[model samples]
Target: MSKQFDLSVMDGMDRREVREYVSSLLWQLRLCDGFWFLNVEKRHGRAEAEAVNGLVWDKMGDLAARDVLERFGPFADTPCGFWKAYEYLPWIPTVECAVEHDAPDAEGVIRGITVTVRRCPAQAGREKHGLEPYECREMHETEFRRFAARVSPSVQVECVQAPPDPTPPEYDCRWRFVLPVGAGGDR
Candidate 1:
C-alpha cells in the first residue's frame, strides 16, 4: 500500500471532485462500524480555506493512522469543503462542534463536565469602582474544581484550554474542564 500511495497525487484534481472521492472512500472503509466527524472552523479567506479542504481530501486515506474520526478545520466554501464533504459521506456519521482550542488537555480520564466563562477588559474610568465585565476572574477555575469534587474519587479532572484571541491581552482568558466521560452524569 505504501508503494502505491502518493501524498501529492491530488494536487491537480478539482477540490470538489477530490472531496467526493475521499468521502466515498471513507464510507467504504467504515465497514458499518465507528463514526466520523469533521469539524471546520471559521476561515480567514477563500484560497487558504480551499487549500485546507483539498488537503483533507488528499489525506483521507491516512485517517486510520491518525486514530481520529473528526477532521477539524477552517475550511473553504467549495463543494468539497467540510460541510458538503460531510453531507456526501453521511454514512460515516459526522458531527460539527466548535473548535475550542488548538491543544486540549486530556492527560487523564474525562468526566464530561465543562465550564466556560468570558473575561472582558474594564473601561478606562471603571477601575476606581472595581466594576468589570465579569464578577470574578477566577470563577471558571473555581467552578471546575467544585464540579470535580462532586465526581467519584476515582475519576480525574481533564483540563482543556479555551481558544485564545489577541484582541484583549489583559482580559480575554477563558478556561474549561472536561469531566470523566460518565462521571458528570451527562454527555
Candidate 2:
C-alpha cells in the first residue's frame, strides 16, 4: 500500500519560495503569541495573563519537544543529543537564540551547553510599545525543563538568567543544560 503526502499550500513551490513562506510563518507565529498575551493582559491583568501564558508555554514546550522527536528524533539521551534536537525547536528561528556548547572536561565528557537570547523579539516588542517587561523567568524555567525532560528525563535544565531577574545588558536570558556524569556525550 502507498501512503499519501499532503503538500497542501506548499506544493509546487521552489526552494526559495518555500524558505520565504516558512520565514513568514515563523514571524506570524511569534506575532500571534505576542498578541495573544497582550489581549489576555488587557482583558484580565498582567498577573492573570502571565499565569495563563506560563501554562500555555509549559504545554507548548512539551508538545514541541514531542513533535521534534516524532519528526526527526531518536536523539541520544545526552547533552549533545539535547542540543541537536534543540536546534530544531520551532522557536529557534523566531527567538533568535545563541547557543554555545561547552568544552569537554579532562576526561572528555560533555558538560552541557548554554543558550543566550541576546535580542529577544518578545521583550523588544514590549519595550517598543512602552510596556513593562514580562516576568518570564518562571515560565521559561518550566518550559525548558519540560522540553528537556522529553528529550531525556535525566537531562537537567537550569535558568541562568531571565526576566524578573536583572539580566545583563548583553543578553535577555540565559539557560544552562546539564548532562549527568554518565549521560554519555562527546565533544
Candidate 3:
C-alpha cells in the first residue's frame, strides 16, 4: 500500500528537482507501480502552474519495461485510451524542468518539463491485481507520441523495444522521446 500525491499542487520547481522529489516520495510510499505525466504551461517570463492526478500516477509500470510517463500533467483530466479501466494505481508528485532549445528556424523558447514514475508491468499487475500476461506485455512495448504543428509544435516521444524476450511472447523494451527542446521550435 502506497500513499499518493498530486502535481497540481507542486509549483515553482524544475524537472530534475521534481524527479528527485517524486523519487523520494515514491520511496517513502513504498509504491512499486506508478507513473506521473507532466503538463507544462508556457507563459510570459516562464511556464506557469498546472495540475496532476494522484490515482493515475500509480499504475504504469512493468518489471520488463521502464515505467516512465512524459507530458502528462496538462492533460490529467483528458480521457486517455491506455489507462481506462485500472484501479489502485496512485498518482504521485511530478517535477518540472526548463528546457533550452536551439533550432535553425526557431531559437530561444522556454519549455516546461515533466516526468512520470511507475513500477514494471509484471510486478505491478501481480502485486496490485491479477493482470493478464498480454495486457502487461502490451503496456511494455506501447509507444506514445504527441505532435502539433503550431504553438510549441511537433514533439515525438516513444517507448523503444528492448531485446526480444527468449520466453515465447515476452519482450524487452525501453522508453524514448525526441522533442524540440530549445530555441528552435521543431526540426
Candidate 4:
C-alpha cells in the first residue's frame, strides 16, 4: 500500500506549538526564495535571475488566487472582497503589513483599499547580508495584477510605491486596489 502523509501530523500540537510551527515554515519559505535567487544570480546573472523570479511569482499569484477563491469564496466581486482574499496570500504572514479600506459611501459602495508594508523581511534580510535592494516594482505589479484579475476580472491594482522607488519614511511600499465606477458602485 502507498503511504500518505499530511498536516494531520500537527493534529496533536497545542495552539502555541502550531503557531510557532507556522512561523518557522514562513521563515523557511522566505529563506528558500532568497537563497534560490542568490544561487541563480551566481550561476547565470542578475537579469536572468530576476526574469525567472518574475515568472515564478506570476504563476504563484495565479495559484494563490485560485486557492483563495476555492477556500474562501462567495466574496463580493469588489475591491473589499479582493482585499479579503488577498489577505490570505501566504506572503502576507511573512511580512509586516497594514491595510486600510476607504469608507463606503452613502450607498455602501467601497471603491478602493490601500495596503502598506510597514517592514519587509526580504529587504531586511538583504540589508543584513550586505546585499543591494532588489528592484521589485515590475515583478510585484505583474503578481498583483494577476492575483487581483483572477479574483475579479475588473479589479485594478496600482503601485503607489515600491523598491527602486522613493518610499515614505514610515513605509517600505504601498499599493492600491480599486474597483472602477459602476463595477461595484460609482463611489
Best by TM-score: 2
- Total backbone collisions for each predicted model: 8, 0, 42, 0
Off by over 4 Å in 2: 1-6, 182-187
Worst 10 residues of 4 by lDDT: 1-10
What ranking of all candidate models by lDDT puts the best one first?
2, 4, 1, 3
TM-scores of all predicted structures: 0.22, 0.91, 0.26, 0.90
RMSD of each: 18.4, 2.6, 15.9, 3.1
Measured with C-alpha atoms, the lDDT of residue 19 in candidate 3 is 73
* lDDT values, one for every candidate: 0.34, 0.84, 0.29, 0.82
Candidate with top lDDT is 2
TM-score of 3: 0.26
Tens-digit lDDT string for candidate 2 (111-184): 78888999899899998999989999999888878888898666788888898999887889998888877666
Q: Which ten residues in a row have the lowest lDDT in candidate 1?
A: 32-41
Q: After superposition, which runs of candidate 3 have C-alpha atoms over 4 Å from their true positions?
A: 1-118, 121-123, 127-132, 136-143, 146-152, 162-173, 180-187
Model 1 agreement with the true structure over 80-174: per-residue lDDT tens digits: 22222233343323322222322323543222333222332222223444533222223333433332332222223343443222324333343
lDDT for 36 in candidate 3 is 21
